[model samples]
Target chain A: MSDIVFTNVARNFRRDGKEFPALRDINLSVRDKEFLAIVGPSGCGKTTCLRMAAGLEFPTSGTVAVGGVRVTRPGPDRAVVFQQFALFPWKTVAENIGFGLVANGVAAAERARRVADVLKLMNLAGYESAFPHQLSGGMQQRVAIARAYVLDPQVLLMDEPFGALDAQTRVVMQEELVRLARVNPRTVLFITHAVEEAVYLADRVVVMSRRPGTIREIIDVASVRAADSWDRFEKIEDVMDQASFVHLRTHIWRLLREQQAPDDH
Target chain B: MSRRTVVGIATLLAVAGLWYLLTAATGWVGSARFPNPAEFGTAVKQIVTGGYAGARIHEHVLQSCKLVAMGFLVAVSVGLPLGLLMGWNRRAEALINPVFLIIRPIPPLAWIPLAIVWLGLGDGAKIMVIFFAAFVPSVINTHAGIRNIEPFLIEAARMLGVRGPRFVFGVLLPAAAPLIFTGLRLSLQASWTTLVAAELVGALLGLGYVLNAAAQDIFPAMILTGMVFVALSGAASTWLLGRLEQRVTRWRTA
Candidate 1:
């Protein structure tokens, strides 16, 4: 069964007394424990799709349902990892990770236990007291992911979570993410502009067309990465070297490049 | 001492040495208008050991501090919450901002007459004047502080089930604290300035009272000493607040 279902979703934002469509007729469903990546150019509403699922924004014309209930607003059952990390500056890594549990009124002792578990899972144990600014970009993103994981949400929504990191850091983070998914599997809807990242991480990649974005194609990552033995390519370079990886990357690039920009003239 | 501290002390001494050379050593300006370093020392000693304007040096400092504290505490307690609500809610801003704008631009000293009429020339009148001086900036800075908090942080808080009172305390306040402290510092400095003005208009004891009395008596040494006290107190309070800011916001990067 699907964990998240979007039914004919359309969103329009009113600006200067005019309704501008952000997403239109978008229908998608994320299966339980599936890793789905949505890729498109900027302004294609890929992030909007993730935000809708997170219940941060509601579609103007359609419904977004999580675990069979219609989403009205954000809830603890679903968590988001923002592009900027969104870790509270005043809070240490551990406090930021435990913020949700504290807000949910988890007892302090239980909060500490769960926070400790996630810290060890994300390899953030010793850095608990370090503030976000004290950490490197990669480490901060790990804290962000750990924060989401600490809540044990049924679905995770990430909006370019690694978009801010340097390329070298991005590669390491990408490998860590897949490692994280293997240990703590959940329904994930990841949004990104990097086609290679989509091909690298996602079970299936959803390509979106420009402006008032709609899904153009859904490409299943090929046999090499899709096989049960895909774990054999544990290293990112090894995964990149696979012939199927290059083919899927080229395919998504062409699909994205072929889409025309919406004509306003 | 650290190099930075050593350099800072050296700079202060050099400035004082230059002042001594200009006034006491060369006697370029007469002691009538400009008191020499030796005279300044004597005036301070006299004030400390004896008294100034019928009140000792410590009494003048204490009185001025009390007036500032009264006005400052009230302004912050009222202004910060009011400004936060004003910035957070569109309706609150629309309703109260116009009256605030009208009151804010009028100089605090300009309220001396109105305060005298309403509250009389007691401590009440002086505090009222200082209140206006501190209140305007307190409100403005608090408003800006709340408004300047990143929108993403608020969204993150909401997603974590932090809303209403919890949202304000857990997220908004801490996130806005660095800026709020800045507002507090500015409000405090403003209060100190208006303290002098308030005492100059009416009061029996304060550094400002001492300065006015010394000016009228044409004792330049006494005036200079009073000026030094005021400058030193202002610097000291600001430094104290800076230290407090550092202690509270250890998470913030310099």
Candidate 2:
């Protein structure tokens, strides 16, 4: 079953009392356990698509459903990791990660156990007591991802999760995400402006046109992932040097760059 | 001790030495303008032993402190929740802000006449005055604190299945805690100032009454001692509040 499905989805934003079309009749489905990334230039409403699935925003026209049911509001079945690492600053890392469990009425012992497990899974075992400000950007994002993962959500919506990190840290985080995916697979709808990140991480990369964002093309880049390629590659940056990776990245970049050009009459 | 603490203490001492040099040793700046160090010490001992305006130093200090506490507590109890509710709900803000804005700018001491008529010349009147002083900052800061939070933090909390009153208390309250503490700190300061002002007008026994009595007698040293006690009490409470703020917002990076 496809965990997330956006069928004929359209979103219009009201700005200064005028209705501006953001996403135009988008049709996409993030298959169960599949990692689907949407890449586009800024203002393309790629995030709007993710927000629809996460139930943060409802489509103006069409239905965005999960597990065959309409997603009317945010639920425990779907978890979102924001670009800003939107952690509760007053909470310790463990408490921040365990917030969802607490909200769901998990017992204290069970919440603690799950938090500790996720902390270890995220390679943040030693930093349980550390606050969000105390950690590096990469570590904070790790906690954010772990926070989402601990809920065991069927669908994980990541909106430019590595966008705030330094270039080196971003590369490292991408690999870490891939590592987590291998160990525990979940349906992930990733949104980003980076074409290369979309190619390296997503099973299928959805290339979107500029606002009134339409799906220009959906490229299948999963074939590029050799069975042992993730394990063999020391860094996600190493995958960028390969010919197949280069070609796919360039093709998506061209589609995005072409959208920036003046339209025909 | 940390260099910062050492430097702060040294600065205070240097200012004290300057005061002593100018007033007592050099005889520059008349004693009438400011009391000498010896006269200030004698005033302190006199208040401690002989009493000031019929009450001992500790009695005056305790009375002032009690009034401040009552006023501050009442202000916080009313202001903080109102501010948080105003911040969280648009309808609440619309309903309450108009009335709050009308009351906000009026000086707390301006209520003394109304307070006297309403509650009489007891602790109630003094507390009412202090309450107004502390109330404004508590509301303004608490509202601003909730409003100024990163929108994504709210979004993130909702996305994690936190909603309704659970979201407000669990997420919004603690999320805005840094600024709420800032509000509380300002409220504490306002309470002390207004408490003194309230006591000055009519009280029989407070540090402010001591200041009024000293001024009546033209005793600069006694006035200085009263002023010093007010400062001491205000500073002590503020320091304690700051420590609580530090513990609550320990996640904040220095």
Q: Which TM-score values does chain B get in all models? A: 0.96, 0.95
Q: How does each model score on TM-score?
A: 0.95, 0.94
State each model's CA lDDT, in order. 0.89, 0.90
Model 1, residue B66: displacement in angstroms?
0.5
Off by over 4 Å in 1: A222-224, A260-265
Write candidate 1's Cα lDDT for A1-265 as tens digits.
4388999999998889999998888989888999999999789899988888888888998899988988889877888999999999889999999999989999999999999999998889899999999999999999999999898898999999999999999999999899999987889999999988998889889999988788999988735575635678778888777777888889898898877565622
Determine the iRMS, in angstroms, of model 2.
1.7
> What DockQ, on C-alphas, does every prediction get?
0.64, 0.64
Tell me the TM-score of model 2.
0.94
Candidate that scores best on lDDT:
2
Candidate 2, residues A1-22, lDDT tens digits: the string is: 6488989999999999999998
